[model samples]
Target: MNDYAQYEKDCEAIRTTNQQLLTEFSAWLKTAGLAAGTIKNHCSNIAFYVNEFLLYEEAIEAKDGFTEVDAFLGYWFIKKAMWSSQASIKSNAASLKKFYTFLYEKGLIDKQALADLKEDIKDGMPLWLATLARYEDPDEEDVW
Candidate 1:
């Protein structure tokens, strides 16, 4: 009886659209057996993108709205500049490209927007975390 009740509850929870999709994606990722670190990285990147999208929506004062792809990238990535590190920003950009590509493939966005997002990343920006993580070469043992 308890097992059956639990199964019923799980089935009921799976009926919601967002829950169903999230469950399916999670199952797929689990079956794919990605490294734990990789899964964390991907999830973090996706969260960052979604957070920026929500911020963009709020900025426009739209009651119920999503930013066009251009406005999202331009304002979130180019204008506000919220990244703490170059590597982190690069990772987020790569994640956005993958995410928008998925959306475009699913017919959720126009192809032109994705195409316009393909500009080369500018190099030479020092990542703050990477700078902090640096340590003196172990062979050179002297330090004041």
Candidate 2:
């Protein structure tokens, strides 16, 4: 197969794996006693992160996505998601934290990686919210 063909194949496999992971994550959330609506929202946020943003440019597995949270929330999500707002940004960050913690407990990621992801979310949230404000500002001269 050609390179592009291989890329497509890889992406399909990743999507399938991500779907299963999401199912497992949802079940895990339920075991933790999260409300149904909260579980749904977390799964939805993670689904978009892994399936859409991760796969947008390459076949990035959810296991490898911890590193991309900064870029995703700091720019891509703010610009791409029509529902982007301060509240949504914070919500997504919380969802990601929960999802990654679940992944860590399942041994999909190491402790250090989980810690780093949490730290990145904590530190980057301010900038991500600021970016959202600028992106949504009608009067901001340089939104990008």
Candidate 3:
């Protein structure tokens, strides 16, 4: 096939894949009994990850770069928030990780990507504590 033809075919394949992903996501949301507003929120979160992080990485950082599942956890949850309080950050990370796991299981991305990403985050809390303890006395509950 000609180069133009090959490019067209590739574009078509990607469109089809995206359509399927959207359909599956909607079904999953329904089966999970998610409310419409919550489903919208989840879709927005996914779009944010794709547009802000994944697309930026692909466009500027590396031509072949796709989504880094771990980055979703770190960036969306840990970095995108107004506050970095431990409890909120942990909760956000858990939610984002769950979304990534869903995408992985759906075959939208490689499972190892999510697994390795989560593995990298295994020491997140402890690492944060090591840094926090450097400046604050952990013995005092009201210090922070």
Best by lDDT: 2
Error of 3 at 72 (Å): 4.9
lDDT by residue for model 3 (1-144), tens: 986676556555544555565566666876789888767666555544444554442321111223354454444434454554566445435545656666777765586777665665575555543434432454656322
TM-score of each: 0.45, 0.97, 0.49
lDDT of each residue in 48-111, candidate 2, tens digit only:
9999999998889999999999999999998899998899889999999999999999999999
Better of 1 and 2 by lDDT: 2
RMSD of 1: 12.9
Which lDDT values do the candidates have, in the order given? 0.45, 0.93, 0.52
Residue 124 of model 3, lDDT score: 59
> lDDT score, residue 124, model 1?
18
Model 2: lowest-lDDT 10 consecutive positions:
135-144
Model 1 residue 84 CA deviation (Å) reads 1.2
Better of 1 and 2 by TM-score: 2
Q: Which ten residues in a row have the lowest lDDT in candidate 1?
A: 57-66
Ranked by lDDT from best down, the candidates are: 2, 3, 1
